[model samples]
Target: MIYSSEHFSISLLQPKDALQLNKLLVSNTERFIRFLPKTLEENTTLESTQYYIKRKIKSAKKRNEFVFIIHDKHSIDIIGMIILKNLDWKIKKGEFAYCIGKRFKGKGLMSKAIKATTNYVIEELGLETLQILSHKTNLSSVNTALGSGFEWQATLKDEFKPLNKAPLDMELFEFSRPDRF
Candidate 1:
């Protein structure tokens, strides 16, 4: 089922969306890589992306991971994507990740999307804590996490090495279920 709100709708990524998804990733690769691992943008091909998305959808079903596309209601254009992965039912925790197209930045679209997606993760998926990891250099991502109610956590030193880049520090953030607040 699609999750809808006044500003945007979150829906499962489908096979038919392959072309559009590829275009979205290609167009936003530079902006996306600033916060994500650089390897995601490097060596990306439509076919490989298609394969990856298809696998994510299947994995979402099996592992309770949810991958959603954030779309503008009026324009029907995809603005971003959010992923909840590694759902551990015993711990009631999951890893959260997201990317918004450059064109849609600073419009509060991602904050809305995060609110909607987190609601689903909590109400529908029964998750308690959402963990978000981002590069220290990406302030926008850090802002998004904070805006979405994630608390700042300690930084991990030299935890990740982006493709073709030196090891970098990563900031770990956490947002708990409202009841935990």
Candidate 2:
């Protein structure tokens, strides 16, 4: 399903998005490589991006994960991606990860995506809690998570090992649906 607003839209990443996803990754490699090391390693080409998209689609069908790409409402250009992953059916919780192109930074696009996705997770998916983990130094990511209503949870020690860099700590943030009972 597609989610939209006046400025941008969100849709599931499909095989048709391979070329745009590849270009986005390549153009923002330096900025994203650290956060998306595994994804960058796997989807290095258009063919690989297509393969990745197919896998994600299968995961969504299985109710395991949902990945959405953020696009400009007018131009239809991909600006970022938001993923609801690590879903635990028993616990009613999921993990989130998001990234935006450097050119699209500081525009509040990701914050909107995160908030929209969180609502979908809670209302449509029936997930109670959504968690986000970001490198402590990534102020933009931290701010986006906070602005999206994810509260500070904890700091995980040596949570991420970026390429060619020392192990980094990650701050965990979480949002949970209010109790109805």
Candidate 3:
């Protein structure tokens, strides 16, 4: 299902979206290098992006992970992506990882995208808790999480390790639904 607002739309990443997704990542490579290291390496080429998308589609079908594309409302251009991963079915929990093109930042787009995806996890998918981990210094991500209604939970020291980079500290933010009770 697709979610939308006046500015953008969000939906499952489809096979045909490989090219657009690749472009988005290529353009945002430097910005993503620190937090999205593995993702950056996975989509470094058109063919690799195709493979990544296929894997994501299969993962979604298996209910293990999901990748959603964020697009401009006026066109099909992919501007960002949100990943629902690190899922723990037994604990009813999951973590979100996201990124948008540099041109799309500072416009409140990611925050809305996060909220829509979070609703899908908590309401439709019946997950009880959600988390977003970002480097404490990444104010944009930190603000986006807070804006999307996720509360600061804790600081996880040395929680993120980028390729060949020193381990970095991350701030954990969480949102949980009580309706399951």
Which structure among the candidates has the greatest TM-score?
3
Clashing pairs in 1: none
Q: Pick the candidate with the highest lDDT.
A: 3
Model 2 ranges with Cα > 4 A deviation: none
**Model 2, C-alpha of 124: deviation from truth (Å):** 0.9
Question: Which residue window of length 10 is worst by lDDT in model 2?
Answer: 70-79
lDDT string for model 3 (116-172, tens) is 999888878889999999987899999999999999999999898888988888999
Looking at model 3, residue 44 earns an lDDT score of: 95
Compute each candidate's TM-score over C-alphas: 0.88, 0.94, 0.96
Window of ten residues with lowest summed lDDT in model 1: 34-43
The per-model lDDT (C-alpha) reads 0.78, 0.88, 0.92
Per-residue CA lDDT of model 2 for 99-173, tens digit only, reads: 898888998889999998888779988999899999877999999999999999999998888889998989999
lDDT of 1 by residue, 96-138 (tens): 8898888888887787778778888888878899988887667
Give the RMSD in angstroms, all C-alphas superposed, for model 2. 1.4
Clashing pairs in 3: none
User: Per TM-score, what order, best first?
Assistant: 3, 2, 1
Clashing pairs in 2: none
Error of 2 at 12 (Å): 1.5
